[model samples]
Target: MDHLAFDDFPDGLIVAGPDGRVTYVNERVRKLARAEGDEMIGMPLAEAMPFDDLNGHTWMECVRPYDGLNTRSAILEQSWYSPRGSEYLITASLKRDRPGGRVQQVVIGIRSARVRNRHDRERSDLVATVAHELRSPLTGIKGFTSTLLTKWDRFTDEQRQFMLETVDAEADRLTRLIIDLLDAARIDSGRLTLKRGPVRLDELTERVLRSISAAGSEPSWRMDIGAVQTVWGDEDRLVQVFTNLAENAMRHGHGLRRVEVVEAEREGVHGVRVRMCDRGPGIPPEARQRVFSRFWRSGPGAGSGLGMYIVGGIVTQHGGLVDIDDAAGGGAQIDVWLPVNEPEALRDGDDRGSVIGSGTTRG
Candidate 1:
């Protein structure tokens, strides 16, 4: 944990004394430069590291101290390319001793830019998805509302009722989409909290199914309420989990006909297993593992792509298991297993981490 232990740091680190002589180079830096550790210790930093920007500016300029003490200076980012075209981002900073005192030391940190660049692309993809998803519901609501308001007397009672109903449905969709976005942010920032207690899974399923039915999701549904017992969890969160899965089934089941939920015993595990199966095109074998990924979509549709991911997070927080399978009638089957005796929530020292984790496919 000391300064010298930078050797174990993931980022490359190097230190130069007041005279700009190389005082230390951690193992990470030595490995990155493909040079001996001791060989880099005594030489001038310029001769030892010799890092540079692609624009031809030497890293020596980047590490140079400004005209103040205790006022650290830094180079935000400098790009370097290896002989084989590998890229790195080197950030150098100067540490000062006291007000107007000499520069105490210069430190350089290095990290690969490949991962950062990939994340940038993923962020752009998320932005595009959000835009398209939000636009769909907004467009429907606007069109229907404007027509009804401007031409109220022109339509028959049935037609007006249909228009009003469509508007209401679109509004509801917009509200849910916004809530999903908020949930995603909360989950990512580790701010999601759960109120835990004993919850009846059978009753919760019936309530969620009633809501789905009221939404007019066109799918026949059945539930086998076994002699399952209560599980300790956040009742609202559990409701959200099944609601999400059921909605997902209604959406992806292009040919979706029947959706079923069953509570049954799982061998070798002291818990109840609830399976939600749909009769649709069925998730592709290879894609089953990735359906819970955030902002991931298997096809074109109006969805924020955060439902399944949120479902996974809530279940994980409750110390439960979730998996996918091929349903009996050739569709996706999602299984959730919750222990009758709920396990303690996970924590990190004093901070209680969020119940949800990253929805991104990669974690």
Candidate 2:
């Protein structure tokens, strides 16, 4: 095999001689260990990439070559904890030149378990959160439909219509929840596709506000459109951002006085800004920074915790930024800063951007 190819391998690689002396290491090993030069080449395997067993003995001693005649090869997976508190999945394979021959070398492959474990936990938490979120709407639809079907003759027209409306609303909620899961998957895979175009921020805000009104949500919304209303972005995505923010305001704002959206420009900033402010219980100081994190919830009845994350992702895709702060009068304020002009790179899809998934995960 070409040795140079190993340098490009996705995982770290280390080749040790039969006597357990480091002979070669790929670029990944150098990067993972933050090593330089030939410092790691002549060192013992454990010395270069240290690992201690439960008994405090070197990992090398625990997996040392077996003496029996039939013991020809061995493979094991172990967790390697770095001095810097990083974790790696270490897969070590000891191979003999031929069956029953002397153990020639041990090939070790290392990958960052920290990133993998984090993603796994997030996925697991998402599945659980989705299941919990789906139960309420599904139960509502089923219970109402069952009751209506059994008591068709006993119900008044008004009662029947009310139940049917409830079912419809619950169904819509389920659809939104499912769409969010799909979008999350797409975002994770980095396959989020955006249809870039010129979007009017003020018009989009009005449309979303009208949507909230039509939904029968009782919240006063105030809009302020500044000089620059149009931006280069995906129209549908921009609409989604507005919709989520409006809904979030309705759900979280207590004694909800009103939702105010303002689009303006700052003196030194290069982009147009949109601020969504509500006169309700504002976010706490510490929780402000984590509102946009996936599966993060600061309080009960907070939607699936995916709303702000999705909002963050979409704004970032447009090369914009979203931040949370206290509204002027004791409420939560979310500020979205978007560039008036789209960068040539973003328009051409040449820049790497994160995908924004929608749906609520409020508890």
Candidate 3:
């Protein structure tokens, strides 16, 4: 491999000789470690740099070469601090190489954990504020409405009916908002739980279609249920995933002529792959990576922007991967790849009654 190509690698790369001296540091490493101007080559690995891992270990300790070539690789978590003293956690992998019988090289790849941590913190704060603001009013409305129903016999029929309707509408709004909050919280904390079981995916799709249809939307929907019959996941969270995708299409599929949800199975490492596609104006290439990020909205005042975030989180919690790509006919397609086998049992005890919503996913 050309040495210059290492500079373009997305992750930071550092190549050190067997003597524990730096031979080459990639552009990414230079930028991240703030080592500019003079080449890092020829400097002792430990003496030339000052960096600490997330566990407060020295960079040298974290990146020490292992005994075997290509067989021993380890992940190191490091912390990088900003000028203002905010810290970021980074995870890097160190790989050992021995080539030409005379050279031993160690390559390091670095990724910033701080960016993800900061985004997570901001999302949590936002969800908390929204939930707190909405909870009080919802509680009062529900409480007063319950009181009225208790004394319904004293009120005229029309008065009672009106009160009931008001209560129902408020309750519905509160329920929807609360669900959104819960989802936001679950996603932010990386604690979203999945109850994996054999699921009839087509049945789930049809059920979601019927539910969406009942809501009185005119958008044309086409679904292709291929030979795939079963998936392993929490049925309810899977429903939430599809429902959020459909809701996103309804909200953003404005300019498109039709929206379609297709289901099919493709051979995957762990199992089969299930996908969902939409006909909304295709997401721009630049924004595709961040589409699943929390509170990421494309256009001005477009949405709360947590729909796809929740979808990604729920799918991920199930040990699955989700992605956005261009639709065949012009739109954005969201595909989710789930393992057929159940993932490792969740660490948190099985407690299924928790509700999911915008800012939080539980009580």
Candidate 4:
């Protein structure tokens, strides 16, 4: 059957004859079985590929392919354990000569379960993180509002203000989380378009510092704005980027000390760079690779864990990059670089399309 065609398939493929004996099998099948030469050919299909179900029944015993109802045409993909106890996913297509007829051939496909298992783990992580963040603020807001509604006159003016402020802060946090989720969705779907423009790095950093000060930040903070030129990017999105980076520093950086905005010229690319340095225990070397990944966090906090991932997407969209390193003295440093070269055609408010496609919008 010119078995070479099936041998090139990535997943394991095996064909069983009408009598249920192995007619053909791929290299992947042989490799999985650890078979040598043509040893796998002509063997009983069940013995050649001994995958067992949760009940410890082999495929033949579980499915009873030749003995099943004549209407059955396929076996759905599912997880099973091989003879060596490694997990795998297997599926089958039963080729019949006619409806209600006996199965003429059984074509089986199998692959390792690692990729699906990893994706499932990541999805579970996202769900858990989102649920935790959502519950915290919602609980606070609900408790405070219910209390104020039932006992407004019993609380002093200062107490009332404190309660209201807490609610407001929680609301803002919820808003930020929602926006971050939307931004992440847009980035993932390649629909995150930038309204191109020239953004003043100095002015932007000043605005961020002002916002931080208004938030009642401590005096431990300092800034040094260098003679950097205006960068070509989206002003509002860049603000979101800087805000997330600065907030991440404050939240996880333990003792965030300073932010330095300076002109950077690297590899003939003239642009501006912002460094957020802290005095807290720095991130470990191994954990740095996961910094820009979605829903990643070092410890517990109010963050949605989507901040760094969004920041990375925005910076990448701007023809820039984001990296983490040890701070000047200690702690962790997050450096962001945005190139100054703007396409002559793209201007402020111009839809520059998504970063993935550059000039193409999603259909």
Backbone clash count for every predicted candidate, in the order shown? 1, 9, 16, 0
lDDT of 2 by residue, 1-363 (tens): 366889899999988877777889898889877889777897777676676543466556666643445464655677766666667787777778788788788788888787889989987987888889899899999999999999999999999999999999999989988887777666667777789876767567667787787788754655555454357788898888878887777777752344333344555655667677876788888987788777687666877777777788888888788888888867888888887676566556644232222221111
Q: Order the candidates by lDDT, highest first — what do you get?
A: 4, 2, 1, 3
| Model 3 stretches astray by more than 4 angstroms | 1-167, 255-267, 270-274, 298-303, 342-363
TM-score per candidate, in order?
Answer: 0.74, 0.66, 0.51, 0.78
Model 1 pairs whose backbones collide? 294-359
What's the CA RMSD of model 3 in angstroms? 13.8
Question: How would you encode candidate 3's per-residue C-alpha lDDT over 5-58 as one tens digit per residue?
Answer: 787887666666778688788887788667785568888867544565445666
Which of the two, 1 or 3, has more TM-score? 1
Tens-place lDDT per residue, model 1, 89-207, is: 88777776765567877787878888988998989988988898899999999899889899999999999999989989999989998898888877788787889886777667778
RMSD of 2: 9.6
| Per-candidate local distance difference test | 0.73, 0.74, 0.64, 0.82
What would the C-alpha RMSD of candidate 4 be, to one decimal place? 7.2
Q: Which ten residues in a row have the lowest lDDT in candidate 3?
A: 354-363
Model 3 Cα shift for residue 210 (angstroms): 1.1
Summing lDDT over every window of 10 consecutive residues in candidate 2, give the lowest-scoring window.
354-363
Q: Show where candidate 4 strays beyond 4 Å.
A: 5-10, 34-36, 46-52, 55-76, 81-86, 93-105, 149-158, 218-222, 254-258, 299-302, 345-363
lDDT tens digits, residue span 265-309, model 4 = 778988888888988789898988787888776677636678889
Strongest candidate by lDDT: 4
TM-score-superior candidate, 1 or 4? 4
Question: Residue 50's C-alpha lDDT in candidate 3?
Answer: 57
